[model samples]
Target: METGWRRVSARKSASRFRRSTSRSMEESTSSAWRVTHRLSSRDSRLRFLAADDSGSSSV
Candidate 1:
């Protein structure tokens, strides 16, 4: 095996691996954020409903 060719191939593979990993990370982060946002909104709505129900009951 030629040392120079091996080095070049290793570098190429490393760069390709980095690009793929970065893209996957971005996708996962976006999906996670979307899920978190959806959950938070739902929780807030439920809390609001509970508060409204209590206020009406007290009145």
Candidate 2:
């Protein structure tokens, strides 16, 4: 009977760990996406500035 209880406890612990890990993974994925989006926006702004600079230099 004690062994059965231990098994049930272990299963519950494992389920909880899986749920926490899944939540963390989702958070990480969303954060990564936000970082990439910010990086891309910065890159686009730099490209526009460079184009303007070149155009002014040519004139």
Candidate 3:
């Protein structure tokens, strides 16, 4: 294999790999953030419900 051609091919493949990898990473990060946000909001709602329950029971 010619060294020049091999080097060019390798560089092209490496850049392609990086581009795909970064795109996937961004997608996963956004999905993860969405999941976490939903969970936190659910948790807060649960806490509020529990508090309301206790207060109602006391009254």
Candidate 4:
């Protein structure tokens, strides 16, 4: 029946859409994690530099 064929096609389309959306979500999460890690590292380095400068000046 035509209705049966249409139902199968709809299911296939839904699955493909789900896969694409999942991939995009994964990529976005990875990028966000990388950005956050880089920012944290930069902040730590700045703190270290500030501390070093203060220590050197005291002498």
Candidate 5:
């Protein structure tokens, strides 16, 4: 009877650990995406500004 109870508790802990790991994985992925998007937009803005400056100087 004690062995059966221990088995059940072990399974419960394993499932909980798996759930937390997946949740963390999802959060990290989303944060990474946000950072990438921000960087890309900033890069595009910088390129645009550079182009504008060059065009004005040429004119």
Candidate 6:
């Protein structure tokens, strides 16, 4: 019963996240790039490229 309840809660949150992302891929994509830029400033170009790839794939 405890495990079942945990699964249900996790599913709910996962669906909520999926809904938010899928509903506005453009918004998420922009936000993603923004963060990537901020991170890439302190990180590597490879990470930036990885982020861009993921963003495009999601779209």
Query: lDDT (CA) for every model shown?
Result: 0.99, 0.99, 0.99, 0.97, 0.99, 0.91
TM-scores for all candidates: the values are: 0.74, 0.62, 0.72, 0.60, 0.61, 0.41
Weakest 10 consecutive residues, lDDT, candidate 5? Answer: 28-37
Error of 5 at 5 (Å): 11
Residue pairs with colliding backbones in model 3 are none
Could you give candidate 1's per-residue lDDT for residues 1-59 as a string of tens digits? 69999999999999999999999999999999999999999999999999999999999
* lDDT (C-alpha) at residue 52 in model 2: 98
Name the 10 consecutive residues with the lowest summed lDDT in model 6. 39-48
**TM-score, candidate number 5:** 0.61
**Per-residue alpha-carbon lDDT of model 5 for 1-59, expressed as tens digits?**
99999999999999999999999999999999999999999999999999999999999
Give the per-residue lDDT digits (tens) of candidate 6, residues 1-59: 99999999999999999998887998878899999888878687777888999999999
Q: Give the clash total for candidate 5.
A: 0
Distance (Å) between predicted and true CA of 36, model 4? 1.0
lDDT of 5: 0.99
lDDT of 1 at 33: 99
Candidate 4 lDDT, 1-59, residue by residue in tens: 99999999999999999999999999999999999999999999999999999999998
Model 4 alpha-carbon miss at residue 12, Å: 0.8
Model 4: which residue pairs collide? none
Task: Please give, for residues 1-59, the per-residue lDDT of candidate 2 as tens digits.
Answer: 99999999999999999999999999999999999999999999999999999999999
> Clash totals for all models, in order?
0, 0, 0, 0, 0, 0
Candidates, ranked, TM-score: 1, 3, 2, 5, 4, 6
